[model samples]
Each structure stands twice: as C-alpha cells, then as structure tokens.
Target: PTMEDFLQPGNKQVAAGYVIYGSSTMLVYTTGRGVYGFTLDPSIGEFCLSHLNIVTPPDGAIYSINEGNYNHFPEGVKKYIEYCKQEDKPTKRPYSARYIGSLVSDFHRNLLKGGIFMYPPTASAPKGKLRLIYECNPIAFLAEQAGGIATDGKNRILDIQPESLHQRVPLYVGSKNMVQKLQEFL
Candidate 1:
C-alpha cells in the first residue's frame, strides 16, 4: 500500500479512540460529543463503562515528556521545561516529571490525572516525531472532547493539513490552562 492510503486530516474524523493493554485492558474514545472510557471485564468478557463524560482539570501538577532529549529540544520547549521545574508554590511549580516513553501510556495518564504531554521539535527531529494522522489526531480529538486542548504549540491539532501519511508534528496536549501556559512559552 502507498502512503497516500493514510493521508487524511484529523478534522475529518467523526470518532477517535485508543485501547491500553496493561494490568487492566481499557478503551477510551470520543464521538465529538464527549470522552468516555471503558474497562474490559475479564469475568464478563465485555467492556464495562468505567468513566463517563470525562473532563480534564484546567490545571495540574504533572508534566510528561522525554527529558532525555532536553538538550535537543527547541528554545521555547527548553524554557517551558525549566518553568515546570521551578520552585514556586503559589502556582504549584516543580511539577512531577513522568516519562514512560510510551505515547499511549503518557497520554492516558495525563488525560485521567491532568497534566501536559509534549512532543516538541528538537535538533534531531526538527519537524517533531509523532505522526500527524494516526498518532496525534486521535489523541488530539479525545483531548479536546475531554475539555482539554491539543496544539502544535501554536496551531490546533485538528486544524493541521496533512501533507503525507507519515508526516510528523510537534504536539503539546493536556488540560486547557496547562496547554495555554506552554503556548505562552512558545
């Protein structure tokens, strides 16, 4: 199959979701209305509604990213990382840094717990790394529907025009206020 088979903008999707396979298998999705989550019930062999109409908090005390790439990150992202590590209690500074190097895991945690998950442009990956259509789109859609925000540090994720099937993009998604604060740094 050619790359053209996968070239589609995120905004075209009417629904988007993801499944996490861990100690407890879970599915999360949205239909442009709201975000919902279900857990696989092993005994019943069915998905049971676990979270209904999930809503993300506007502010959080966690930041998820691959800090190993700190030296390679963009100037704005670098500053933002420093800001997350600052020692100001008034605004809940010095947020916890959690990075499992797993997009699904990181995004899922931030979605449920409230935080920012960023995959910004770096020296090695000037245009960013996560694919626009498959990787970023679904998560971006869920983020918005769950009362959060998803952006490329500037533009909305769903509004991005896909140039190729595997096009990579910078992604900054999470609670509304947290994402907006990162935008300020950008």
Candidate 2:
C-alpha cells in the first residue's frame, strides 16, 4: 500500500468517533461536514437513526483531565489549572472539573457539551500517553469537523506524522473557544 494506507497524520482522516455500549450501541462520526449518530437495533440487526446532524457549542462550564497526577504535569499545565480555579465572573471562570479517564466518554461529552479535554506532556513522559495514529488523529478529525480544535501544545494533532506505531503525544481537544483560551495559559 502507498502512503494512503496510513491515516496517522490526522489531516488524511475524513471522520472518526466511537460507539457507546450502554443501553444501546451508538456510532458517532464526522465526514468533515457534520457529525452524526446511529443506534444499533439489535432486533433488526441494523443501525437506526438516533441523532441527526450534531453540532458542539462554542464553550461550556467544564474541563476534563486526570488531575490526580497533577504533580507530574508540566509547570504550564499546573499554572493553567490554577488559573481555572480562580474565580472570574466576567469570563465565567471556576469551571467544573470532570474526568472519567475514558477517551470515549470524556471526548464525547466535550464534543457535544462544549468543553475541553487535555492530556499534556509531563516531566517524566514528555510525549504524553495518547497515541498519534490510533487515538489522537481520529479524535482530532472529529473535533475539527465539529467546530473544535485539537493540538499537542505547539502543534496541531492532525498535522503530526507518526515516527512509529504506538507513538504518543499530548492532546488538547474540544470547544474552539476553550482550546484557544487554554493555549494562552500554556
């Protein structure tokens, strides 16, 4: 296969999302135009209409990340978290903190509700935990298509070509407004 076989550099990806295996299995994805969701009908063994064209809000009242390992994150991230804590009425500061440690859940919520989810490179693991190909690229595609942004601090997540499989990188993905404001703190 040619370079076309790889979707590492997220720019090549037309769409991406995952199914939530809850009351039903739902598939949500975007094709650079809009995001859609389909529910699996077990009885008919077919995907049925569940969600029509979905769009994320410009901002929200929550931010998601693993704050339990706060000490491991870089100084910039620490500072940003502090900033998020400080109350600012004008800009709607003191946002709620939410972390489920599951990409599908955290990202899906942020995708629909308009928040930010981040995985930053730290003192020990400089590259961060999220894989460039299998995880970040696809998620970034969906985020962008839904009017959001995804980045690895200094670079766009979709712009990075993997040096190898299992390559890890930091990720900041969600509402365009939230991601932009977070970048300022970083």
Candidate 3:
C-alpha cells in the first residue's frame, strides 16, 4: 500500500490493543469505549472475561520514565521527575517510578494500573522514537477512551498530523491529571 494509507489520524483508528504473556496469557484492548482484558484459561483452552469496562483514575501512584537518560531530558521533564518524588502527603508524594524499557509492556502496565508513561525527546533524538501512526496514535485513542490523556509534551497525541509514515514524537500518556501535571512543566 502507499503512504497515503497510513495518513489516517488517531481519531480514525478503529481499534488497538495487545496481549500480555507471563504467568497467564491475557488480551487487553479497546475500541474507543473503554479498556478490557480477557484471560486465557489454560484448563479450558479458552479466553475468559477478567477485566471489563476499565476506567483509569485522574491520578495514580505510579510514574514510568527512562531515568537512564535523565541527563539528556529537558528541564521540564527533570522538574516533573522531581515533582513526582516530592514528599508531599496530599498528592501522594514520591510516586513510584517504573521503567522496564519495553514500550508495549511498560505501557500495558501503566494503561491497566493507571499512571504516566513518558518518552520525551532526548538530546540526540529530538523528534523522539515512538512512531506516531502505529504506536502513539493507537495508544492515545485507548488512553482517551479509558478516561486518560495522551500528548507529546505539548499537543494532544490524536491531534498531531502525520508528516511521514514512520513519524516519531515524544509520548506522554496516562491518567488525566497526571498527564496534565506533566504538561504544566512542558
């Protein structure tokens, strides 16, 4: 197919989801309504209903980011990291930072558990790394449907126009308030 085929916006995406294979095989996905999970019942060899109508909270106790490149991140991101670790009692200070490096895995955990996952543009890669059409857009769609938000540190992830088939943009997606907090620093 031509590049035009991938020019569709995130809003136009029909569906997006993923499967997690660990102690149990579970399929999680969304169709713009809400997130849901189905577990594979090995005993019966069939998927069983597990999590349904999943809704992420406005704020969560977790924060996910690649701290290894902390020196390469922008000042805004650095401050946000500090904010997450603040010892404030009201906003749940010192939020747990979870970064496993796998986009799908880390994002899946944050999606279901409720938190922020940020992949800001570093010093070397100013455009960021995650592809817009395939990765950011689809996840942004699900984030919104699940009562969350997705952004590229500034604009809405779904609102960004695709300039290329494999466009990369900084990603920040998670609970509504958490995302907003991150944007404040941006």
Best by TM-score: 3
Give per-residue CA lDDT, model 3, range 1-186, as digits (tens): 887788877878888988888889998888877888899999999999899988888889899999999999999999999999999999978899999888877777777777999999998989998999989998888889889999998888999989998999999999999999988998
- lDDT (Cα, tens digit) per residue for candidate 1, span 1-186: 676556667888999999999899999999999999999999999999999999988898889999888899988888999999999989898999998889889989999999999999998898999999999999999999999999997799999989987889999999999999999989
Q: Name the lDDT value of residue 122 in candidate 2.
A: 77
- Each prediction's TM-score versus the true structure: 0.95, 0.91, 0.96
Please, what is the whole-model Cα lDDT of each candidate in the order they appear?
0.92, 0.86, 0.89
Error of 2 at 166 (Å): 1.5
Off by over 4 Å in 2: 2-4, 41-44
The candidates, ranked best first by TM-score, are 3, 1, 2
Candidate 1 has an lDDT of 0.92
lDDT by residue (1-186, candidate 2, tens digit) is 655476357787866778878778989988888788899999999998787877778887788989988989888788878877889998688988999899888988898788889899877788898899989888888888788899998899999977777889999999998888888888
Off by over 4 Å in 1: 1-6
Give me the runs in candidate 3 sitting further than 4 Å from their true place: none
Measured with C-alpha atoms, the lDDT of residue 186 in candidate 2 is 82
